[model samples]
Target chain A: MTEPMFRTPLRRVRGLGAARSGTGHFWHQRVTSVAGVLLTVALIVIVISLLGRSHAAAVQILGSPLIAILMLLFIINTAYHMWLGMQEIILDYVHEDKWKFLALMSNTFFVSVVGLASAFAILKLSFGV
Target chain B: MADYEARTSSGARRPRPISPHLQIYRPMLTMVMSIVHRITGSALYFGMLLLAWWLIAAASGPNAYANVEWFMGSLIGQLILFGYTWALLHHMLGGIRHLVWDTLHGFDPADREWMTVATLVGSIGLTVALWVVGYLAMGGPR
Candidate 1:
């Protein structure tokens, strides 16, 4: 669809194009990326601490409230960022409409599965369930 | 330019160029890093599976967690983990570079190339240093 010629000055400033939400993806990708910078460091430290430790040791470390919360935030942010990134890739490479639709659908599904699985794991450990 | 091309009078769309002539051009460091950024980003998608598996195993109790630890301690798994570590670092550095550019600075060609080189080198260096620390934390030389 074509953009309206009489778009408001603010709309022009926002530059949201025909989709009316083009830049939101780009903006949020950046937001998540900044979060990832911090979250990933926390993740690396946690993983390193877990190395050479047994299951019980791992549980003792991860089951802490602060670590669990950080992990949940990491999972959520990473999953959203991943979905955005893969959606862009699929849109670019999967030119056929049907295949593109399938890829996009599976992208969300995959991200959700990974995110939920990880989140569930963290919660299970944290709650001792 | 491709999108700007008009359709034929009969309304048939024509093929269009999609990117800079990548095949014909000499590879620049920035160009290489641009591609690497995408590659590392994609690699992280698969790496996330490893993470999910680890978490799920940990949650499932000792036996399941032991299986995961066995695999992760194997040579192949270590190699995979090493590659994943490098990819994560490279992608994170690349994202920082992009963030810098979004501020509308660092567009100087020389500065761009320098940042790209730094990203490549820094990712490798950080990955190695992190692993060293990790090994030491594990009591070393195992």
Candidate 2:
């Protein structure tokens, strides 16, 4: 039989490519998603608890250390997870290289702005500022 | 080495083959769920803005909080929030389904359908239950 022309299966799977980050993106996405299963549930409960509370009441509820920490965790986890996801979507659909680069850049900016703002708000509330 | 050098010198890239086009398959629950997973995820991406606004308003003090609260308490706001709730829960369940598959289980044809169904039913049930609890917490039937 003739020798196989393509790389071996084991060879193909090993090592990072030109991007220097093989599987890192996929791995981090899954890790964050696993954390998200619990965070999302906690988030829903927190929102439900605040349903009809007054401003001061909502503040009081969110001010507690436990709740504030959970909120911060959820915000950070979600921001990262969604950024990874949207990057995948943009890479897949936005075929034009110029537009694809622009989309990816915008995704980073948007997630960072929203995430930092939300985190700041939580910190302010937690510190009673 | 010479062939490699020549190819590199050319600096031209050939188009790569892509997966089969989507039109080949009839719609199925698995396919539908996969699409819904992406859609809900995309929706929740924007939904973060709502969340950010809520937190920022709270931080900015009572007057800002009250204005945000009033809008959130309005009919349109409630409708938007209701949709957001369902999307959030649905995407979370979908993520769990993915996590399970990543473990190399739940791939049976019947099992795949069941998980998709569970994702759908569970999200709707949780959304309704949470809203019911919210209404109840608001001091019952209005």
Best-matching candidate per TM-score: 1
TM-score of every model versus the real structure = 0.89, 0.88
lDDT of 1 by residue, B100-129 (tens): 999999999899988988999999999999
Candidate 1 TM-score on chain B: 0.86
lDDT by residue (tens digit), candidate 2, A1-129: 865978576665576767778789999999999999899889988988998889898988997899999999999999999999999999878988789899999999999999999999999999975
The alpha-carbon deviation from the true structure for residue A20 of candidate 2, after best TM-score superposition, in angstroms, is 1.3
Clashing pairs in 1: none
Q: For candidate 2, lDDT tens digit of each residue in B74-124?
A: 999999999999999999999999999999999999999999999999999
Q: What is residue A76's positional error in candidate 1, in angstroms?
A: 0.4
- Among these predictions, the greatest DockQ belongs to 1
**RMSD of each predicted structure:** 4.4, 6.1
Backbone clash total, candidate 2: 0
CAPRI grade, predicted model 1: medium
